[model samples]
Target chain A: MAGDGRDERAWVRGAQAGSASDLEALFRAHWARAYRAAYLVVHDAAGAEDVAQEAFLAAVRALDRFDGRRPFGPWLHRIVVNRAIDWARARALRREVLAEAAVSAVPAPDDPPDAAAPSAGILEALASLSPEHRAVIVLRYFLEHTPGEIARMLELPRGTVNSRLRRGLDALADVVEQDGEG
Target chain B: MTDLRTELEFAPLPGEIEAQQRAWRVVEAAYREREQLPRRRRSLRPVLAFAVAAAVAAAALSPPGRSVGGWIQDRVAGEPDAEPALVRLPAPGMLLVAAERGPWIIRSDGSKRYLGDYEDASFSPQGRFVVGTAGRRVTALEPDGDPRWSLARPGPVADARWAPSPGFRVAYREGDTLRVVAGDGTGDHLLARGVAPVAPAWLPREGRTVLAYARADGTVVAVDVDSGARLLRTPRARRVREVFWTHEGLVAVRTQRELRLHDRRGRLLRAPAAAVRRELVAAVPLPGAWIMYAEYDRRTNETQLVREACFGRGPCIAIGPSRFFRGAGRLRDLTLSPDRRWVVAGWPDADQLLFLRLPSVGKVVATEDVRREFDPGGSGGGAFPRLAGWCCARASG
Candidate 1:
């Protein structure tokens, strides 16, 4: 039997009983995983934090409704994932503006920052990917979730997730190749 | 050259995930502190007793049958209107609300010469008329605040919305039945009956309206308002928070997860199912596009902004660390200028407005203190957030 799972379940039970202390314990226990999950998708610290707290809050509200048979971590992780997706959709306009600004601010090939680091170039490439493609890469690589896990988390078919993982890898190869050329 | 995905797998860009977890603990502690009772007890028994005595004396002294509204009018009826405050319009003034306390129509200046209590108030896209509910009364008022007409419905009027183009229709809830009134408040037609819905979302391109009913377990039901024919029913979305119809199509923000975009026929438009794991504070639709503002990374205390094309095929843009502050608070209620040039970012807790020059190089252009009504740093303290809705007008060429 998983002792940590029992403790997590106990904390959830305590939270359901109006125990703020238990809720805080639960937040401390699960917040990092949730934030990491969100960060892998949005790649933004602030947005990840917001998603983590909201996910925790949602978990608290629905704690009583939680079937004790299942683990709470996955359920809470689902909330974080959903919140990040909504945030991505809502900020569509601001991202456009930021991308335009970023494109304009990007230095030329011979700029001073060009030789700063190969890693920066990789980041730029990752950032330049479509949110969907970027998410697939982040889930498959950054978060280290399997195609099956990603498919279940995203509510897509396993085949779709596998194809996306493959295509995402191909796109990443292109990006890294472009950076090497530069 | 190493493949980017291979390298990313080997070494993830450091994002203080552990620190963020610690910060979330602090936030959770802070909320618990607020929940702790007897922290501060400032009683008003003495003040309440004195106020009661004064009210009794005033009531005894006043003449009979003189209502409070009447008495106030008698005292200040002839007073000149107050000077109009030069408050900046957030979104081309497409949506206008009187500065007065009640729902009475005030001339741009703070003067309530006309008196009509609306349960709620809204301005048309042109700002040429007002829509509101006053008890069982639903009325449309011209720009001058004069009632163009009023409709007395069967149920207590719940909510009223107007479509910007192709004519206007108002949705009202009477008991459990939902009804729609025409532009003139006539032809009191039963659009869909037995729907205890919060509000109806008018789908773009199509005249069909989507409403979430208790029967649908809060899953949104899209129906053609004119014909009452059901168009589409969204799957049972878990913890569905908000559904908005953008210029592109219908977008539903399901809690802290994915923003599903659906066409009028309810087909998923995007592939790979793009998702963000942040709690979205607010979303503002741009001209043929939309912007989402959300809080990110608990410890870092930053927000993210995302951009998506609304009209047709275009790549989705995601901007992270949009704004960062020392303290904790989520971004709420973002207002894009009518021209979509400026964005007013509101933080309900901070009661602060970050006036952003649209398209800033991934950073806030400026932050301003505009928290007269909103408590910039208070926890769920005021109704300003609820009353802080904005409307965008198509730019006039």
Candidate 2:
């Protein structure tokens, strides 16, 4: 995962003992994936930053009590995805409130999120699915968590995770005609 | 389905690097504040025990109730890597400190000179001089502790704030009355009677002599000291403790319960919504249109610092309530350096003075045994010192 993740345990031990450099190494290793996974689910730049930052802060706070033997990635990813889903759900409710306020609250049609990029086509399609469905898809494909792991991370039934993954994939299957890189 | 990980990993996000830098600093600060779980170091335990035994044996021979443990801790209270003392400031400004002895002027090089006994002190606009008040007396001294002028008032004076650029006037509280004096400590006249116990703030606009003070009735008023015209006044608010004016023409009023932003017209502007059960203790306006504040949680007993960036003058647009520093106990004296690069405050419970690097931090410098530093000879170390203000090389509005 992050440089074979062999160093993760050592970094956690060092960070728990008041080593800032070890903490930085851990943060740098996981920040990208944590941020991107949150962005894919929340679909807002600021929202993703908040989710990822909050996840990192939580990790730092729990560093003392954390068991270094356990993997840090899954723990951090669970926080990221859950917070992102919460943020997306909150934003959805805010949209409904603004919608009731006036007709002008509606945004103009966006150009596929990032029109010039070919990947935006897939992202636009993913954006259409519910945040819960997006979380399962993101955890499965993006963070590379297995169905069992996703269920545990999200505290959902494995069957529910699989159903959301299937529905999410079916939605994006047409949008992305070609896919590359494992 | 082919893995979309490759695309998701590289998708462009706006301000990613900036956000990472900002978030890393906040996370790092929280980590630094945390007391790490004691790690097993069996080899060093004996050595530490010997040292502790020696100290105890030395203390046992001393007078009853006086332990050398506190004196020892007063010498080494911070991290082993922390600088033994404040050798230099991260930013390029001078800091004014009110210690148990008196006010001390600390230059950029970290050298300090203590003025003779005074209870409180504040820096002039350009760091050219200082005005110190001690029990029925107010004295203006050069940075080198030479008296430029001294005056005896009928009542004790404190919180003397010099007006903005060209720095021609100073405002101080005499008894319950507010008064303003010329920069040379002459032409002293009463501005408002029966003012609150809060410090007065000068609106930092060039060529403008707008002075803001809270009334006894909880009304905050900004009046032109020269023309005696009311610039702005707020509806009665309770227990106004401190008033801070910004260069961007916004005044932030901090009461016991909440901190709020008011524009030049005195209309209360919407602030970043604070969560329930959190008490707002202090707020200081930064160089840009930004204000940094500390919120103390009653339930958790944690203090959190938040930074807000405001745009426009009146009916301002507040961009963020971004989290800055979170520490145990309360972080008091939220003072910003002149360059807006560092926020210096005292963490009382930790007995450490925190110098929080602004915007973001790869470097967090804290001075330990803060009380002892202010109390040299280390008898036992007085209460923590007050960070008067961080001033610039020259005066500016």
Candidate 3:
């Protein structure tokens, strides 16, 4: 994590100066983690890609303004999380507009995500949690960020992060247990 | 314990990491391209101002000679580029896009001949005719793209809706009053006045229209249009949430924790405490006793649809997990088909649009092309409900 952060910072500085290669290097380095964070939160591959890309783009755009003192993962997570929120809000607005348009019955489902192969039921169970809880799980377990780092990234009290993590775990367990019922 | 923590420690979700890296490459390349440019001494304020001015101007000008139908065809041609302006609904074959700038149309077929645009586009219970707006301007054209009417009124158009018959209505807000106009922009009447209404929803099979307004206390008041009578005044649930009226009942996301449903008479419906919930994406009323609500399940990383009671007789029916377009994607802009059998979700960041079949809400029925129209900052058109459709009376003869 330390090496990744330091290397990412170097790339960030170069990208801020508009170095394409540096930006590419940074993308190669952090895209997997960023995408995983977004995918775990959104569970939609298309959306995950966009979120990950947006997070990187935001990092590059705001790189000049970046304090450079903090870890890059937290900063990037903040961007990805914020973009995800915006995506959620936009989705809600579109739904409202559609409802107003007088559509009856449920619309069809979305296309399935092209996962490498479906992960274990844990992935499915993970999908059952709320976005807030999912975020905590992703940050703590997936991204391996500390509760304090998550607090700083999400702008919440450390306690809130801990609670979200605890609740997320509980919820995940419940979903997995329920799945096992069948 | 299988150690969910161990699961997280595992490498990224398989191929997802590669896909994201590819996407990142695009953004990085684009940014690097931006950097190499001569440092623009000019601030972006002027460019933004110009763009805004252009959009305003575009809103002002009408699409020439093109009927609402033809305009739809022209826009459909631009779909391959991920056009932000054009969107196809999830039905077997339907497209909802800005055909000619202002008039949004729902096309049954890809052709413009099957297209209809509303002056004020509000869909009916079944996604029928493009319901015309009241008091506002309508760009009506013949099948050949000949302009038949460009109707504008003196007062601001408040709202518009289609009656069960071919008849439609539009309500316009003129100062403190509301002016209701028929679907064709004729037979104008003052449905209600002095209420200063915001969202006016028409009840099924009745002349009754419900007008919701913000009270001084920040609560919302649902008033009847016919009697100018206040039905139920409830505390404002969420400052930025949408309310729906259906034959089954009235449903809205009062808050993330509360899904409120009421009958036509405003009776209370069941409220469920969800363990994990994404924001309410969209709700589609079904033919019989169903209304499917789309939600992004942040927990499972899946988009979910829950079917609930419209008759106040039953609880929500889980339509089961839905499939999303991008592998491990997030839900963006989504639209449900009129039958509630299909859902279309958009992800602009990946420049992809998806249409999925619902109830058995799995499997992709159609995947179409999309073109990016505008770029404000990162993506001017990330998934917002840019897609819409309505049911209006079409001559069955």
The most accurate candidate by DockQ is 3
Which CAPRI tier for candidate 1?
incorrect
What lDDT is reached at residue A43 by model 1?
54
What is the per-residue lDDT of model 1 for residues A80-127, given as tens digits with 9 covering 90 to 100?
A: 664565444323433444466786465422122223223465566665
Stretches of candidate 3 above 4 Å error? Answer: A1-182, B1-95, B98-100, B104-106, B112-120, B123-159, B172-178, B187-199, B206-235, B251-257, B274-277, B297-303, B308-340, B366-369, B373-385, B390-397
Worst 10 residues of 1 chain A by lDDT: A108-117
Query: What's the TM-score of every candidate structure?
Result: 0.43, 0.55, 0.42
Which lDDT value does model 3 have at B299? 65
DockQ of each: 0.05, 0.10, 0.13
* Higher-TM-score candidate of 2 and 3: 2
lDDT (CA) per prediction: 0.49, 0.71, 0.49
C-alpha DockQ for predicted model 3: 0.13
| lDDT for residue B237 in candidate 3, whole number 0-100 | 50
Tell me chain A's TM-score in each of the predictions.
0.71, 0.88, 0.80
iRMS, model 2 (angstroms): 18.2
Instruction: Considering chain A alone, report the TM-score of candidate 3 relative to the true chain A.
Output: 0.80
